[model samples]
Target: MANARNLSTSSEPLNPKTFLSSIFDAAVAAADAKLTIRGHLPQKPKGRTVVVGAGKGAAQMAVAFEKAWDGPIDGLVITRYGYSAPTERIEIVESAHPVPDEAGLMGSRRLLEKVAGLTDDDLVVALICGGGSALLPSPAPGISLADEIAVNQALLASGAPIAAMNTIRKHISTIKGGRLAAVAWPAKVVSLVVSDIPGDNLALVASGPTVPDTGSRADALAAIAAYGMKFPDAVMAHINSRAATAPDPADEKFARNEVYLIASASVSLEAAAADSRRQGIEAVILSDALEGEAREVGSVHAAIAREVATRNRPFTKPVLILSGGETTVTLRAKGKGGRNSEFLLAFAIGIDGLNGINALAADTDGIDGSESNAGAFCDGSTVARMRAVGVDAKAMLAGNNAWTAFKAVGDLFVTGPTGTNVNDLRAILVR
Candidate 1:
């Protein structure tokens, strides 16, 4: 990683909007594949060096790898629609994310076939990141892509954490759970991973196509039962069977593989903090791996900010409180809000009339949930502004419709397809 420069030390006053937005941008840029992929590249092999990956950022990872490698390289990667990048040797295939599609099925089949019959001298560079699980949907034998889609839908709506969801995904998929690595056999597979999992678990990022699996079909079944996720009878039988199990971690095929976490929410949070300090404000990183229900997490954060605003107890006044992680939203209604928007909605209502408190919550990947906006911004007057537009802020949150409320109040943060994913970056500036 490169050094974080002190951007400014002047005595000028900070603009809350501009400063908070910069903190977000700094967090996202810190995890960009262009900056994070250079040093992590493996030593070129004497034989072929093929790249295969799938994620929202896989296209950009391919571009960076091409620029960094001196030897010839060619392969394929699957990225979400509208997140594709131009590359000469590597083919960038656009696919659906958070849900697999026909394009992903075809692309995933091509990706799996790219590494066939590799020798010991050949290298398989796997550029893994967030959203790879849904972007590459090569279903297991005797299962249809529709079956996998049903599983993904249930997992998403079940509000399972990345691990639980991916546990299920790995057990039923063809390319995931290190099966891709197993296929390469004698070839050394070095994975350059940009982690989006809260705890930096490489195996769960995009279901870890190139990494080993420590989970099994039994875990997936337990997750399904715990969440009360109903599936087709055929699907249930498939999970109950042993054939759905992933390759064992002790399998010799993984002996030569390497995994590197080049970028993550922790590093980005520190980068945001460094940028905050350079702008003459104290930045406190609350945590990098917080996990809970979305609105509940927002309420707790709002309480902290309120306490800071009223009484300077924790760390004194004028502090930028930062956090990063994957927060889940258990769906009770078919609402239009993602986890970040839901978090901001609850937070806005909690600190409705408080002054000098402004915050921005956004996914670093430039998409919050399935919404077009990255996230929504909130401040002391956010609820009041929503009322001005006749939006009942609390009711919106109750209905899980924070995205609509944010849009109605004109505070939706927009940064389309940032070519990276490090999960969510949230900043609360208390003045």
Candidate 2:
């Protein structure tokens, strides 16, 4: 964790919105790949040094690597369409995210070609971040791109855990599950990753494009059946026919590969906690790896906040309860909202009419689920404000219309794009 610093505040009372926002900001600033990659650079190689990357932060990671290294770097990186950064030697290719597209397929093919014929004297630096799976959707030999897209759609709505989803993604993918590292076989590979997966499992992040994978096609099928995910014949055909083809742990190809955890949710949460401490507020970090239904998680947080407020059993008043991790939301209704909105809205309802409680939840990527807003803010009066605006908080949540509910109350938090992804950061302040 970084050093803690006090937040500048006037003599007046605490501003919940501003306080929560500052905490969130500190968390995001800690995960910046451009800053984090400086301490983890590899030595200059004898032959050519190629950089291959993918995810929302891939473009920025490439730019940072280009600036730090003292050699000629030429390679391509795929990122979400709007999440590109300026780079001199490295080429950036914008593609789709949360779902694969034609552009991702073409860029994936090009990336494989760039690292295919590397020599033992060369170096391959893999810049991987959260959204690499959808950004590098190069399907296996017999599977079509359409098949991959179909599976992606199911996985997004399946309400399954991220590990299960990435396992399925890796099995059907040609560029994931250490296949990328295998392609650069004899050449040394170093991966600098901004992890979104809980527990900082590099093998599951972006489906382990440059790391060994222990998951198999059988695991994917089990997840599909467990989640009741339905896909078309083509997708099912690839899933059923494919065996466990991902690179094994003892593969000689990955013997020289190196992986670094550049940034992660746990580190970000601790950073936020430290900031809160320096700001004259007690901070309690519940967990950095909490994962479950979004609304349910919100409700649980509300319960904890209520306990702290009513009794102060675990913590005293004026404390900030923090948690970080990627949460899932099942598509219950055809309403417009994301996981963060659902979380905050559920929290609003649970803490309705209760005073001295406020909270904020947001995805580090600046986008929550498929919605435009990064997240929404909720205080004790949030539900009252929604009721005054003719929005039933519970109904809105059930309909997956938390975005609209929060919009009516003017609490939506939009941060455009942070160019980094470490999953979600949530805070509850009780004063």
Candidate 3:
């Protein structure tokens, strides 16, 4: 991996917005496939090298692998629509995310076919990341694509954590869990993952397409039941069928397989912290594994920031409080916003115009929920500025319309598709 020191640091006399952006960029850079993947790439195989993957970062990882590889490599990878990276050898296909589509279904079937005939000498390099669960959709037999999409929509709005959502996903899909790796049995499989889950659980990342699934069908059904997810009869039946069981962990086929976390939320959080210190800011990483309701987490962080800004109990001024991990947003209003936006709005309300505090909350993949904006930003002036415009911050948050509120206030942070995903990056600058 490239040294974090080589990354660009925040300029002197730190401007909050610029400094925060720099920190985010550093975090994303630290997780970029081009920089971290080559070191983890396995030795070239004597037989054909087949690459297959699906995620927001899969296309980018494919590009990196193609560039670094010496032998002839051919494969297909699916990425979120508009998140495709330029690549020569590997085929990159665009597909829907957070919901499955026909494109993903076709691509996933083709990916499985590509590795089906591979021999023990052949190599299967699987690039997996945050959105793969939805990007590589192969509905289990007897389940329709529409049925799978409905289940996914319910899971997303159910406010379930990524792990739970993925558990349900793996049980209903033919490609997720350990099924994908099982199909490529006898061929050496190497999975390179960019983790976007809390605790970096290999089985939860992208629903563990290339690793053994530790979760059981009962676990998946329990998640569905917990979320009160109503799936079609066919979908439910498929989940209950014997075919739904994933490959067992003790399977010898997986003995030759390897899973490597090329980048993760913790690594990116540390990179952000390192950059902050370089700028002479006291950096404290609260947690890289935080998980909870978005608004609730935001309120708690706001309290911490408020104390630091006013009492300076935890740290002195010019402190950057950082955290990484995924947060959930339960849908109450039919509002157009993601977890990050919701978090920022709640945070803004919690701070309530306390001065000298600025913050940024964003998904590292450059998309928050289903919105175009990566996330939103707020400083001391946010609440007052919204009030000045006759906008009720509380009402907007109540309606779960943080994106619209942030858009009205011109505070949306828009970094187009950052070819990676390490979950969320949140920073509060106390000055």
Candidate 4:
């Protein structure tokens, strides 16, 4: 699994409303949102069943588990602020994400301490996802909270892919990189993961707090050096000391751990394709692991959709195309948009008012790159709309201001945290 930063962009034909809804359905299905995990609980573990989790989806997953389970369960979870949901058994703690904060550090400590001293009979259900690496930042020995915060900021600005960012994070933290499970040793660790990374490498999601890490301290150091990052004396010292003796998995005792990838971008894309089929549209899934620059992929998708619409060569008219994966924006311009918005903007520019073609691009979590809107909607009329408002699509794209441009035309689609994250979903419908 790679970090969110490694996501690449690719495109296909999609319809605004139908495509958006289909994508949403696929994300929900991939997350197995309706299949509350508690339904699979092993009959109230012989000992206490403690629910400990961290991520943007942690609170919602905890709530779902609570709703499905029958016995009295007690636990706590930390999630990105504004991503919390009501839960009776599990007390939801709000924390910062994409960047470490004091609350996250404190909460991480509390969760770590909470799971301490678990026996073989006890169980620790870990709900992990894309944002947990930053959501649960617990600095290792001698690394001050401030220092950890500084490193986190550096990593975010570095634009390194998710796997690389997480590699560094695993070494710097006390809970990540299988340390959490190591701490809760002897107890069975049931990790329910909503994978956000390509290839679904379990060890990389959320820094593999519950899963065993195949990476090492050397790998972490390599990532830091690759980015040319400098750390404080204390942080550097810790890294130097552990450089040769990265936390040893064999030394730790979390052998009973089991991880389940409950959701993924591939699964979401398949579900979306199925939804399109239900609508009597010949839907095709382009790729679930598509990566690279967003705008460029948007142009390619537009080209394919245009071909199918005009000549009915590759895919006949009345076809729906779907794709799901995270995309990255290099951010050469001081743009106020996420990759999805940028993709939509570029797609609109490429189509140039191709009648009967519509599309939608959205991040599954309903939030795109620190912005309020999930993504955006585009159609044959999109170019005309921008022209009417005197909005130059090319200029807006160059400025990375697709969010603002879409907002002006009231085409911004906001879903307020859809309670799950499966990267991004793009759908194009040619009718």
Candidate 5:
């Protein structure tokens, strides 16, 4: 990967927004939207092919499936409000994201009703993706959608990782934990997945609606305890009751169920790297499975960039270091900013100056967290800029106010919605 010292800054030209958009476009291209989950569809069934899903990518997947399938197809999908894609046949519903709302709960109920009466001759295509867990929120008996929303908000603010959050969600949800597929018993289930989780664990992605879940209600309670969040007695009782239910049991009904990860973070990263190469920038993807605390990863990347800048070790200059995967932020700040902004802010503090480094951090889905910003950007002079503005970068980092800080410096990248979610992408350009 290129180091900071190797990047040549000139009076020629540079557009931070355009460069970041290019990298994101490459990442999306790598996901291969044309494939979707349709490639895994089984032969035409005697019954109908009902497509049901929930996530940021569900609508897009619906569009892909519509074009690929030649047989009878009808169903509904749920996505975050304003994240909807243009769809002709399948019903696409929008609802609150990151927090389950009345609309999401109703949508989940309708989805369940849609597939409940299917027979062995029918097929159920589940387009699962990131944010589905929140987008398909159906609280179990004794749990209310209001309570679920409260817990979800708390969990998100607690900084629990996506996997842990989904574990809790699966247990609390009536449709998750493979219950959706189980309800469609006798009907063949094909789960087409676009992974947002770091390890691409199908069960954790979208709470494993069609895929079997290895987690249990106990796991959900444990996650709640791990985060020290308070819940109502009814909520606690619901978790206790689910202890009797084994999430993933071997059953004759499940024999026809299958889950496949058709698209992933690595795919997006490789596409970005290829794009960089095409742009005359040598790019190397560090890994597609990178995971950890967001700020810590930022520090590590900054250190590597420093090494390349000062000593040309491990890798020389003029190459872009790229990586994909989900990195989480344990929210300690009341300020606005997503993981991408936090990562960039941390990287900026580490690099400070020494010239010739430019980097971009963004969520492939476009919206970072609940914020409108895709992510944030940093250059060699970022530190100087912060200092000149009389803003204490360290203090902002402490408050988890990287978004506010970046916005103050006009470095936040807001792309609205990119209509995809392959996790996080980082591009470190070393001079």
Candidate 6:
């Protein structure tokens, strides 16, 4: 249990902003590849050691493995553009994220080719994390990169949960949902996963590239229907065609594969909570697997914070409320912001300038949605400050323009690529 006070050795007194930032830093530190990856590393294989992975943290995980392992390793991994870390042995390739691209498709093909004809003695180390589903795109035989992109876009805008999105992704791909692991049949596969999804479902994280998939084509269709998504014809045909089925979990080929959760949102939240307690604040972790719309979740959290502040019904004052999970944002308005920003905006609205309440919400990956900022911060004065500047907070919230609102208030959190992904971390400090 690392103390929050040790996060910064400076002599300055820790204020609300500094304390919140320290809490977030503790969360990110807990999920850092260099800190967590070495502990989960498998023994050096007797035969050829191949490293294949994809995600925002894939490259960093590779670097960590390279530093910890003494054996010679070679392979390739695809990561989001700008999220790539320097690695000497394992090749790193940059590709588009949140949407699949030709680069990702080509990389997935190359990875499959690399694993072909592997003997039972060989080892395949897969570095998996969030954003891998899009970073390692391998469209089905009938689907094109453009078709995959369209379906991803629709799914993202539909506010569908990550599990639902991954179910559909597995059904229309060549390498997802245990298909990657299937290609390396008979070879020992040890996947080191940094989970970003709520519940840490091994099958859902990054679409479970190296684990057994229990979902079926019917599940994909049900998700599409439930979300009212209008996917492209090619995507629909691929799912409806005979090639829709994923690799069966009962297959003996998967008997040698192992999936290890190196880090997760729950661990990160616990780290934050420990630090808050060290700072003499009563920390209450509402939930680490919270899901639903970002705004609604923020509103509910705000209500809880208010109750603690006004009546102390649930807890005493000077309490820090913490949570971790992935929240969705339905694109109702054409605005530039991610779920974290939207959550902060709604929280600000719900608090309504009530004194003695301050909060911070940010994605652990240091990128909130598609925005440049990780997320945003809001205090009791956030609403008042925006109103003083002639900015209507409610109007901005309605337009889904939380980015603009936070930017105007100079509250946008901008920590460039934390080199890790564990989902989102949020904290509300009520005094």
Residues 1-431 of candidate 1: C-alpha lDDT, one tens digit per residue: 23533334445655777888899988988998889899887988989999999899989999999998888998999999999999999999999988899999999889878998999999999999999999989888778899989988888888778888899888888899999999988899999999999999999999989897788787888999898998766678777888887988788899988999999999999999988887767899999998888899999999999999999968677889999999988888888989999999999988999998999999999999898999989999999999998999988988889999999978999999998899998899998
Give per-residue CA lDDT, model 5, range 1-431, as digits (tens): 35322213444464545665788887876665566555666678888899899899788888888888888899999999998888877999998888888999899999999899888889998888888988998888778888888878887777677888888777777898788988998899988889988878888888888777677767777878987877777777777784425456576777878778888998888778777766666788888878777899899999988998888867877778898887878878687778888888889999997687889999888888778888988987887898789888889888888887888789887777766788998998876
Residue-level lDDT for 310 in candidate 3: 88
TM-score of each: 0.96, 0.96, 0.96, 0.88, 0.93, 0.96
* Candidate 1, position 143, lDDT: 86
- Of 5 and 6, which scores higher on lDDT? 6
Judged by whole-model lDDT over C-alpha atoms, candidate 6 comes out at: 0.89
What is the Cα-based lDDT of residue 63 in candidate 5? 87
RMSD in angstroms, all models?
2.4, 2.1, 2.8, 6.3, 3.3, 2.3
Clashes of 3: 0
lDDT of 4 by residue, 1-431 (tens): 13222111214433348545755665566676447465456546888899888888888888888877777778988898999998888999988867789999889989988899989899888888778888888898778888988887677555466777777878778888888888888888888888888678877888888776667777778878876777777777777674424355565476566778778888888777766665556688888877667888899999998998899969876777888776667565676888899999999988887898878898887788778998988887897898899988889998888998898888887888778877788888877
Indicate the TM-score of model 3: 0.96
Candidate 6 backbone collisions, by pair: none
Off by over 4 Å in 2: 1-10, 242-244
- The local distance difference test score of model 3 is 0.89
- Model 2, 1-431: lDDT tens digits are 24533333346667789889998899999998778998999988999899999998888888888888877889989998888989899999999888889999999999899999889999999999999999998887677888889889888887898999999888788889999889998999999999999888998888888987788778888999999999777667777883546779688888888999999998899999888888878898999888999999999999999999999968888799999888888888888888889999999988998999989999998988777788989999998898998999999999988999999999998887888899999999998
TM-score of 6: 0.96
Candidate 6: Cα lDDT at 357? 88
Query: After TM-score superposition, what is the CA distance of residue 325 in candidate 1 from its true location, in Å?
Result: 0.6
Cα lDDT for residue 227, candidate 1: 89
TM-score computed on alpha carbons, candidate 2: 0.96
Question: Which whole-number lDDT from 0 to 100 does residue 347 have in model 5?
Answer: 94
